[model samples]
Target: MVIVDDHALLAESLELALNFEGYDARRVELPEEPPSETKLVSLITRSQPRIVLLDLDLGQHGSGVRLIAPLARAGVDVVVVTSSTDEPDWGHALHAGARTVLSKTMPLGEILGTVRRLNHGLSVLDVEDRERLIRAWMGQEQRIIEIRRRLDQLSPRESQVLEHLMGGLTVGEIAKLRVVSEATVRTQVKSVLAKLGVSSQIAAVSIAHQADWRAA
Candidate 1:
């Protein structure tokens, strides 16, 4: 088994535990600067381990989900062990061809049992559960696309005003910054809310954030 996680301590602990449990587990420490997908795949291929434990969040790479497909092609089976609470990430990992995603909070015994089951040609998750998570990921992706479409409806000025709102600025502050009247800023804010199909500034800001909206 190969463990690919950023945290040194956690990796060490898991290495010790798995080794003690009679599985040859080693940590694949990534470089300080994130490597290219090709380089990453090369390192794992060196060991050619049957199973690789992957973490979804790898610093600069945003998420390690992209690694799953190439690794699978290399004949490595990945079992995601993540501490992230993002349901979308969990679902995304499964979609990228992970064996199963296990929470860090799950009991150690249960995790070991999962590995043991895999060794014996058994699955940890049912087909229904995998389908459910994949469906959830697809739904979240659709929501992001829709929200971004709404953001696209904003005029350039309205987009700037929305940015100010997200930055915690008051209408008067935005007006002064833009060299415009408070009334003008308020009107833009209203237009922003309307175009976003939201009722308030907070809702508009939340939608912008959820969609990761930003000017090119």
Candidate 2:
């Protein structure tokens, strides 16, 4: 097993406990000042641990949720051991392939027991936590459906304009890309904003992000 967390003291303690329990657990070291996602992923790949105990907030290194899917695909079961109380964080971690989400506040004995069970091919999640995750997923699904409906209301030209807007392009830049007059691009932008029920280009981009939408 491998532990990936920015809190050095907590990680070391967890490693010691795991080892005492007869598990071969180790902590990942980031020699670089601020670790990159690529470097962290490579370290896990080389270690090839059966289970990865991950923390979502890696200080300056950003969220560890990004690593969950890739680690799972690489045959490593990810157990998110995070202090984050945010529902979105929990939802994202589980959606990205984490087998279990354990709060850092959980008793050490319980944490170790959960890990042992996971290593033995058993999984566990509390009933309340499971319900929260289901609710979050349902809410996300509804948001996606609404965004798709709004997108479908757009005309072909309006859709093209919205895509460029979401790409961070200026009106002038979009006009240049499409070889259209700036006035024409502005007109299309207005139509897109109206159909999407947004007031500005930024709002349209926000909608795209919220729905995780990209141009088809």
- For model 1, the stretches where C-alpha displacement exceeds 4 angstroms are none
Worst 10-residue lDDT window for candidate 2 reads: 30-39
* Predicted candidate 1 versus true structure: per-residue lDDT over 179-199, tens digit per residue: 999999999999998888989
Q: CA lDDT of each candidate?
A: 0.87, 0.86
Per-structure clash totals for the candidates:
0, 0
Model 1 reaches what TM-score against the true structure?
A: 0.95
TM-scores vs. true structure, each candidate: 0.95, 0.63
Residue 29 lDDT (model 2): 84
Residue range 94-173, candidate 2, lDDT tens digits: 87888888889988898899998987887577667766885796687788789889988888788778888887899999
User: Model 2, stretches more than 4 Å misplaced?
Assistant: 126-134, 137-216
Range of the 10 consecutive residues with the lowest summed lDDT in candidate 1:
55-64
